[model samples]
Structures are given as structure tokens and as C-alpha cells.
Target chain A: MRYSGFRVIAEALTGHKGWKPVWRDPAPQAEYDYIIVGGGGHGLATAYYLAKEFKQARIAVLEKGYLGGGNVGRNTTIIRSNYLLEGNEPFYEFSLKLWEGLEQDFNYNAMVSQRGIINLIHTDAQRDAFTRRGNGMILNGADAEMLNRDQVRALYPFLNFDNARFPIKGALMQRRGGTVRHDAVAWGYARGADMRGVDLIQNCEVTGMRIENGRIRGVETSRGFIGAKKVGVAVAGSSSKVMAHAGMRLPIESHVLQAFVSEGLKPFINGVMTFGAGHFYVSQSDKGGLVFGGDIDGYNSYAQRGNLPVIEDVAEGGMALMPAIGRARLLRTWGGIMDMSMDGSPIIDKTHVEGLYFNGGWCYGGFKATPASGWCFAHLLAKDEPHKTATAYRFDRFLKGLMIDEKGQGAQPNLH
Target chain B: MIINHPILGPRDAQEFVYLGDANLMGRPDGMTAGIEAFHDYLYNRDNPAGAHRELWYHEQGDRSWLVVTRNTVTHEILKVEMARDVARAGGRSK
Candidate 1:
């Protein structure tokens, strides 16, 4: 049912029993025109756009578990389009635009807060780099502003301004970058896709792929064999394992990245802030808790839990950034597997197998790229061509030495 | 996590640096095998969810490269061997 302020008042007056389930839990169909594996944010969004935008029919999304149980729910919820590389900047900017209009379009309250994001600048070299980055962002039609040390102090006076080393000199601010209610994104897209005749099949694990001469067939799942004319795999960290079923190896590794939240307190942080010299980035949630995270657990592992050293490192970075938050008690910490690519950028392209597409290698930044990743993957699946903004996330780029290494770290997934 | 070093009894995981999949040690001859072998060596991985043989450098300790056979799911270390020995066994020479 469509929800609105008027509906709320009517339901309140009439015993409030008129609410309906957000999406249908449909049984697996015998066949489908298109099937998207893994019902995370990217998969759900792909199904949503395929039905709504592309007007495709006979679509199905098969999830191993319930929707939103993956990285969609296991993130710091920060969103931004502030990037430097040509292959990445435009795609993320498109995602930011989608986040801007997402709630209204999907008819859900996703809490898309454009409260701004600031990347602290420490050294003069960082200042020069951020200046170039700001110009690049502006060139891509994304908002960017360079804030001096005084300006940054005016915004967040509680920050450690004058440290012996790594003092905050300035900041690169993006007024449109902020956080979203991540779970609502999954629910919104699920509801939108289900409303558009897409079957969202949960508890259905794809066991194997039935490839006849590699020209596309269907998938064998825990439930049964489900036939599909086309198949798209958007499994984030599980991308390598799932694609391995089709005898294709991806340039991706699964690494655990942990996030933490502090106990609820009065809102003090104005926007998302990142430590210039370290890996810590934090933002105050709508529930008044400080949600923060740092670097990934620099190793290859599928375990959804991290070790202690990274935690200590992140805590040290947080302490170095802001001493006031030291007193706040940490409420909880969780980890999500990251699809860290060799080049640190994502890959959203069709594989060597015809009719089988892949979209993964998002590393730790998959949460912010949800909309554009889905939209681009949907465009590729529907039109059999790469989206205009995402033309560079191909598999052959690594072989051609045209990798989109944003950090300039070569071939090291852990470093990326 | 503790890595039982072959020389040193036990070392904290923080004292080492992780370079992914031990397959990286099997560096293909680029001039002889061409781009396909190089691409496979540089990119693809056997990222199993169970026991994984990976390369770790004792950067903060002995500066020795070691191979650790550990379970990815449980983070349990099964075996540790000097990477030089493993590489030598695989027929690599200076």
C-alpha cells in the first residue's frame, strides 16, 4: 500500500490496521527472462531498474538469505561522490544524484541526508592534491569546496586543530555528500521491484550454473533448477566464489572491514568528517550515535569478523582526530566482507560467458555506489552495453594496464 | 591472531604484513608465457572460504617472508613455513 501523511492520519483514526508488507515473498518461478543473484542493495536495485526503467518482465532475484542481511546493513551509512579518477568520479556522482532523488522516486523514507562531508587536509602536499581533486569534482559537475583551516575550525571547533604532527591545515568539502538510512534503501528497492512484477526469492542459494557451451543457460539453486535467459551476478564479497561456478575467476578478494558505533549522545558532529593523516572516518547518526570505521582488515578472508590490531589502529586514529570522543562508550562493532579488487575500483561488466554478467569488486566503498552500480548493471543487462558513466569498469582493463587505481596502489588488493 | 613463526615461537599477527594468496609466489615467466599468464598471476585468485595458504612478511619482526596455512572462516592457523623453502621446493632459483 502507498504510504503518505494522509494515509497515516487515516490509519491512525481507523484502528491503524491497514498497513501491508513492503515486498512479496514469492516462490521461485520455473523460468524467468532475467535473473539477478544476491539480493543486496546492488542486486535489488538492478531488479528495480530492470522492471521500472527498462520495462523488462519475467525478472527474478534469488537471495541466499534475507534481503539487506549483507553489506547493505553492515556499513557506516556514509555517502559521497568526491573522487579523483576519470573511471570512478562520474559513476559515483551519478550515484549521489540518484541518492538525492531516491526517496521520492522509490516512495520510501530512506533518510537521505546531504549534510556534507569533509576530508581533512594536513600537509601542503595534501592541500595541492585536494585542490586538484576539487577541480576534478567540479569538472564532473559534482559540488566541491576547499575550506581553509579557519573555515574547518568554524565548522567543527571540537576537532584537534594543532597537533604536533598531522595538524589539520584545510578540508575538501562536498555539500551534497552525507549518509542515508541504508536498510531503507534495500526495502525501498525491494518494494519498488516487487510492485513492478519482479519476483524476490529469498532463502534460495545458487549452487551451480548450467552453462551449455558458455552461451548462457540457468542456475541450479538450493530450491531447484531455475531457468533464465539472462543471468546477472551482483554478489559483493561473494563475487569470486559465485562466478567460479561458471569457470571464471575474478580479480577480486574477500576481506573483512569492520565498523563501529558509539552510545547515543547529543548531536555534536555537524557532518561526516575524515582524519587526514589516518584511516578513521566518522559521522553522527540520526539516532545520535557516532558511526565510524577505518581501513579494512588487510588480508584475504571471508570471515565477517576482524582481528584486534585493526581495531586498535582505528581507535588510535580516532583518538588522534578528536580527543573528545574518547570518553564516549562504543556501543557495538561489526564487520562486512569487502570485494577488494586488484586496482581498488569496482568491475561491472559482462564476463567471457555470454548472457552471464558480473558486478562486483566494490571493496569498502560499495555502500556509496549502490544506486549507480545497479543502474549501470541494469543498463548493461538490458541494452548489452556499458552505461555511459561506467564504461571503464571492464575485466580487460587490468590486462591492458588501464586500471583505475585511485590511490595509485598497484595490484595490491589489501593496500587498495 | 598469533602466527607461530618457524624461528620465533609465536608472534602477534600485527607484526606481519599480509600479501594475499600464496599463488602470488608462483610468478609466471612474463617474457616466455606472455600477457595471459601475467594477467592470471596478477589478478585471479583461489579465494577459498576454508583453509587458505597465504604469504605474510615479518616486517616488524625478523623480515622473513613466511607462508601461513590458515582457515579463512575461523582464522585458525594450521601450518607456518618459511616462504623461501616453499619457493625453493616449487623450483625457483636466484
Candidate 2:
């Protein structure tokens, strides 16, 4: 297993002679063992695993933008296996295991900090609900802690102690959960996949998929045509459009999620904090910047610009908890599009088609699931069946009423 | 420390205004009323010398006014945050 995805990436970067450059505009292959579309986290991870597990070289990953220039780099960098579903629980645990070994395996530094992440509970009902989630985490062999107000303050000194619109009465802590360097994650996967002899074609958007007699033959890209034995749609926000090329419809809607940052300040906050009472959470980047975000803007369009309310929420949260940060200048704000599924989880299963596959609909949480999603994706792409880790993330789950409704609200997927 | 002064009796901080707590009430959770009463607190400044609080924050005008809700006993909502474009006119935060 040492000749894993990380090995592949390191091998690519430190060529046999150590003088050759790692990446180039890889020419399209006439045929390959497997072809993955969308070179984001899922795409790159898919290629890396396909090479490691299946020894499937001659594989190709088509990307519309530069590698990691998509949603994979646009997430809040949160890493947690605190899921409350059946199949998702084990696979995310697999991801947590992978995150732990990434620095050693890839010869790269992902800054995988295992700082505890606590989801604050403001309402009594919410306290009860997350209490069960805490139990679930513990039962699954993951680390967890339930904290009262004094404990929360001791853990996070910057949090507002006395008053919150929804005061933090308690929280569910997953000490194993934290964050990674988002962009570095994408780059590590790309380098690893490239080292394993996988073709990563960048700026190569798939315009159409050619199918005949119910089998995928190849794809037509904006750059040119590339023949492949199989294909996957890893575009999170644009999944609907990409899958349409294969004539498939998924129960997915695209929305925009925004994040903000304040002027650089000396490190005061240490870990990732989510104000469950309010729509605010923040993490101090290694560069001394305070990175945070508010709500999801509550509208649907490909537009990646957020309104002021979200910024106000984030800034207000900072001021309330710390108070002294009021004079800290606001530096920058940004947004990214996301593919929200009906159930607040991703759908990583094979379509009815013979040569097409999918790994889309990851909520804001996909960054944590990168390694597992790719590992399971590789399994499905190799054995020509559903993966053991991703059995619940199936297409028919919705139609058959077997949806893994994590939030307990089966009908309200888009809200989160 | 600045909030421990006394206020005139029957002279109460209105609702919606975010006051940390009364100095005497120990900056008691700002005289909390429902939304309607909060709006009414904006107009009425009863001339009760004993009741005159340090800060009369009109919270209806802006949520940024939560800054006053921290430690002060009584907060007066002065102004609300204007709509999107107005903020832009004043140069939006980056």
C-alpha cells in the first residue's frame, strides 16, 4: 500500500532523475483503462486511487480549469467524520484515517490539524439532537466530548461567554475533526495521480459524451476528442449540466456558499469554531488571517457573489465573542458554488449506463470525504459494482425511499 | 465598571435595544421586549432624570448595533444598516 496515491504523486514530482518537471498538458489518450472527468478533489483522488488499486494506468482525468481551481479549493477546509448515517459513517472514518497519513504518504505538508471541532447547541432540542450525534461518534470508535458553558469557554476563550441570541448551553466535540490546507489537498492528489502514469488534462472541459447502444465510447472536450473506456462526472456545482451530456438527470440543485476574512491579526483563536446559535464560524489560517463564513445566501443561481448580510453575520460574530476586534479592518470576502443534494450527502454511484459513473452532490463537507470518496470511487470503477463504503450513496436511494436522511428532515435538503 | 450607575424607577430600557445588563441590574439583559415594544422604545425618551441611562441605542436601525450589547447596561439603537446599495455607496468592506 506504500505504492499508494501519495507514492504516485511523489514519484511524479521527484522523477527518476529529479530534473524533469512534474506536470504538462498531457495529451489525450486514444484508449485507457479508465477515464475520469472533472479534475477537482474527486477527480484527482479518483485517478490516484484507480492507479494505486487497479494498477489502471493509461487513465485520464479531464479538467475544465487548472487542477484544484474548482470547488475543491473553495471549501471551508473543514475535516470531520461526524456523519449520522448508516454507510457514510464507515467511509468517512476511512477518510479520517487517510488524512492522518497524508503528510507521510505524499511527502507533502497538508497542515492536517486535528483541532477539536465543536458544534454549539443553543436550543435544548438541538442539545438533545447533537448529544445523540456525539454518542454515534463515540460508538463508531471516533473521539468525542460533550462540553458545558465553562468547558466551551475554556476551550475557546474568544467565544462570547454571557450572551448569544442563541446562547451556547453545550456542544458536541469531535477532537479528531479539524481542517487541512484545501489547495494543498488538490495539488497533492494531482501530483500523486500524475506520478502513477495517469493523464491529467487541464483546461479540457467535456462538451459532450458519445454513447452508442447503451455504452460510453469516448468524450468530446472543448479542447478535442478523447476516447475512454469509462467516465465520471465530478463537477460539484455543474453536475447537472455535465451529466446532461450523458442524458441523465440527478435530484440536485446548485447554490452559492460564501466565506470572509478580516485583516491579519495575531493568533488569538486556535481552533475551528461554529456558533450553532448563529450562522458564523471561523478558523485562523496559518498565515495569521481570520477565515470565516456565514449562511448559504438562500438563493439559487450560478452567481458566486454574496450579499452583505452574510458578511454582517460573520463580522458581528467576531466582535461579539472577542469585542476588541471591532477596529480590525475587513480584508476580503469571496464565494463558491456548491451542488446541494436532496439528502445532505454526496451521491457516488454508477449510473444505469455501462460506461458512465458519478461522484457528485457533496455538501460543504466534501473536503473531509476526499480520500474516502476517491477510495470508494476507485472500488466501484474497478469491480464494476457499488462500493462497500459508498453503498448508501446510490442513485436509486431517492426513488426507492431509502434516502439516508441525516438531518431527520427528508424533505429539506436544500436548506443546509 | 462604567455600567453600575442607577436608573430612575419605572424608567426602563425598551425592548430590541441590546444592553449588556443594567449596572444596578449588573448590566441585566437589556430591557428585553418583543419587536413591537423595541420599536416603541425608539420614540419615547421619558424625562426621568433618575432614569436617564448612559447609552440610548436604537437597535432597530442596524444589527451592527450588537456591539453595544456586550457589557453596557442599557444600549440605544441609533441607526439600522441601510440596504445593499447604500452600503456600497459608503464603500463596502472588502
Candidate 3:
């Protein structure tokens, strides 16, 4: 059923009995035209666009666990398109545009809040860098503003301006960037895809892939073997293990990135703010909790947990930036397995194997790229070519020495 | 996690920069092994879930590259030693 203001009012008047499950629970089919692994935001959005835009038939999404059980629900929920590189800026800007109309497009309350985001600058060199980045963002049809120290102070007065170690100099602000309800994005896309006759099967772990003469026949799952004409894998952290079944070693590493949330308090933070000198970024949730995160645990593993050293480092950064947060007690913390690529950018290209496609290497920036990732990935799967906005996300870029090194780090997955 | 360094006292793992697989230290002589061997050394490496020996640089400490033996599954550091000593022990003193 379509949701609207009238429906909400009527449901409230009638004690809300007409509410139903967001999407249907369906069994896996024996065969499908397209099979998508991993039922997170990207997978669901890809399925939605495939059925809605491409008009594809017999689509199925298989998930090892329940939907939204991965990084889609475990992220910091911040969304922005303020990038610098030619390979990344336009694509993320497209994602931000899609995020602008996301709630209305899916008929779900994803809570796409466009309050804004500010990346704090600490030194003159950082100011120059941000100036160049701001110009790059503006050139790519995205909004950006370089704010001075006084302007930043006007926005956030509680920041530690007196800290001499990493002084709060200025910031680069993107007025259209903000946060969204991460799980709600998964739900909305799942509902939309279900309405388009896409079957979403949960608890179906893909054990192995059946390849015949370099062509994919189907996948062997926990339930049983399901045949498919084409298969696309988008499992974020499990990309390496899953792709290894096809005898392909990905240039991706799985790292655990931790996030935290403090106890509820009065509204303090008006927008998202990230520390420039350190690896801490924070925003206040609508529930009044300060949601924040820091760097990934620099190790390759599939575990969705982190140790204590990174926690101490993150706390030090937070205290160094905003000492007021020291009073708030941390309520909970969680980790998401990040598929970090070599050059700190993502890859959305076809593998050497026929009938098998891959979309991963999102690193810590996957949540913000959800909408456009699905759009471009769907375009690629339907048309058998790279999307215009995503032509730089190629698997052969590294082989050709044309790697899109966004962070300027060469072949260091964890550094990304 | 706290890693007890051989030269230094117990230090936080955050101060060290992680470089995967201590096997990276044993770079094959490119002049003799050719491109294929270099390619194998660069790309083909086992990613075990259990005990792994990796390269971690003490970037924020003594500027020493330490070969750290740690368990990938449990984040436990089994041993830590300077990479220069490990390289010399392997009879590479260029």
C-alpha cells in the first residue's frame, strides 16, 4: 500500500491497524534471469532499478542473513558528495541528487536530512587544499563553501578553539550534505523491489559458484542450487571470500571500522563535523545521541569487531576537538566490515568470468554512495557497459596503472 | 590492542602502520626472477584467518619497521621484531 499523510492520519484515527509488513517474505526460486547476492542497500536498490527501469523479469536477491544486517545498518548514517577527484566527485554528486528525492521516490520515510556537513580545516595548507576541493566540487555541479574560522565558530561555538595542538582554523561546508536513516534506506528499496516482483530470499548463504568453461551456471547456496542466467555479487566485506569461489583473488581487504553513539541529550550539534587533523567524524542523530566514528582497525579480517587501541585514539581525537563530548557517556558501539580497495576508491567493473559481475571495494564511503552505486550498477548490468558517471571505477585500472588514487596512496587497502 | 615491541616497551597498535604479510619483506631479485615472479610476489599471497606475520611500521614511535606476528581471527600479537634484524638474519645486508 502507498503511504501518505492521509494514510497516516487515517491509521492514527483507527488505532493503526492497517499497517503491514514493509516487504513480503518469499522463498527462493529454482531459476531466475538475474541473481543478486547480498541484500543490503546496494543490492536492493540495484534490484529495484533493474525491475523498475530496465523492466527485467525473474529477478532474485539472496542474502546470507536478514536484510540491513550488514554495513547498511551499522554506518554513521552521514551522506555527502563533497569529493575532489574527477573519478569520484561526479558520481557522488549524482548519489546526493538521488538522495534528495529518495523518500518521495520510494514512498518510505528514509529521513533524508540535508542539514549540512563541514570538514574542519586546521592549517594554511589544509585551507589551500580545501579551496581547491571546493572549486572542484563547484565545477562538478555540487554546492560547496569555504568558511573561515569566525564563520565556523559561528556555526559551532562549542568546538575546542583554544586547543593549540590541532587548532580549529576553518572548514569546508557542503550545505546539501547531511544524514539519512540507514536501515530505512534498505527497507524502502526492499519494498520497492518487492512491489516490482523481485524475490528476496534471506538466510541463503552462497557456498560456491558453478562455473562451466569460464561461464557461470549458477550458485550453490545453503538451501540448494539455484540456476541463473546472470549473477552479480555486491557483498561488501565478503567480496574477497565470495569472489574466491570463482578462483579470482580480489585486490580488496576486509577491515573492521568501528562507530559509536553516546547517550541521549539535548540537541547540540546542528550538522555533521569531521576533524581534519585526526580521523574522527560526528553528527547528532534525530534521537539526540551523538553518533561518531574514526579510522578502521588496520588489519585484514572478516570479523565485524574492533580492538581497544583504535577506541582510545578516537576518544582522544574527539576530546581534542570538542571537549564537551567528554561528559556524555558512550551508550553503544559497533563495527562494519569494510571492503577497502587499493587506491581508496571503489571498483564497479565486470570480472574476467562471463555471466559474473562484481560491485565492491567501497571502503568507508559506501553508505554515501548507495543510490548512485545502484543506479550505475543497474545501468551496467542492463546495458553491458559502464555507466557514464562510473567509467573510472574499472577493475583494469590498476592493471593499466591508471588507478583512481583518490587519497593519493598507492596500493594500500587499509590506508584507504 | 597493545603490542609489546622488542626494542620499545608496550606500545599501542595505532602508532604502527600496518602493511599486510611479512612475506613482503622477502622481495625476489627482479633482475633474475623476471616479471612473473615479481607479479606473484606482489599479488599472490595467502590470507589466512589464523596466525599471520605482517609488517607494521612504527611511524609514530622509533621509525622502525617491525615484523609483527599476530592472529587475524582474535587480534592477538604473538611476537614483534625489527624488520631490519629479520632481514639481516636472512643474510641480506646490502
lDDT of each: 0.93, 0.70, 0.89
Interface RMSD of each: 0.8, 22.5, 2.4
Q: What lDDT tens digits, residue by residue, belong to model 3 across residues A178-237?
A: 999999999999999999999999999999999999899999999999999889899988
- Weakest lDDT window of 10 consecutive positions for candidate 3 chain A: A398-407
Candidate 1 stretches with Cα past 4 Å from truth are: none
With candidate 2 superimposed using the best TM-score fit, by how many Å does residue A351's alpha carbon deviate from the native?
0.8
**What's the DockQ for every one of the candidates?**
0.86, 0.01, 0.39
- Output the lDDT of residue A266, model 3: 94
Provide the TM-score of the second chain in candidate 2: 0.19
Scored against the true structure, residue A177 in model 1 reaches a CA lDDT of 97
Q: Please give the ranking of all candidate structures by TM-score, highest first, separated by commas.
A: 1, 3, 2
For A349-394, candidate 1 gives per-residue lDDT tens digits of: 9988899999999999999999999999999999999999999999
State the fraction of real interface contacts model 3 keeps.
0.24
How close to the true structure is residue A175 of candidate 1, measured as C-alpha lDDT? 97
**For candidate 2, the TM-score of chain A alone relative to the native chain A:** 0.92
Candidate 3 error regions (>4 Å):
B2-16, B32-51, B57-69, B77-94
How does each model score on TM-score?
A: 0.99, 0.76, 0.93
Question: Among all windows of ten consecutive residues in candidate 2 chain A, which has the lowest summed lDDT?
Answer: A298-307
lDDT for residue A100 in candidate 3, whole number 0-100: 98
Q: Rank the candidates by lDDT, best first.
A: 1, 3, 2
How well is each residue in B1-94 modelled by candidate 1, as lDDT tens digits? 9999999989999999999899888888767988898899989887888899999999999999999999988899999999999988988872
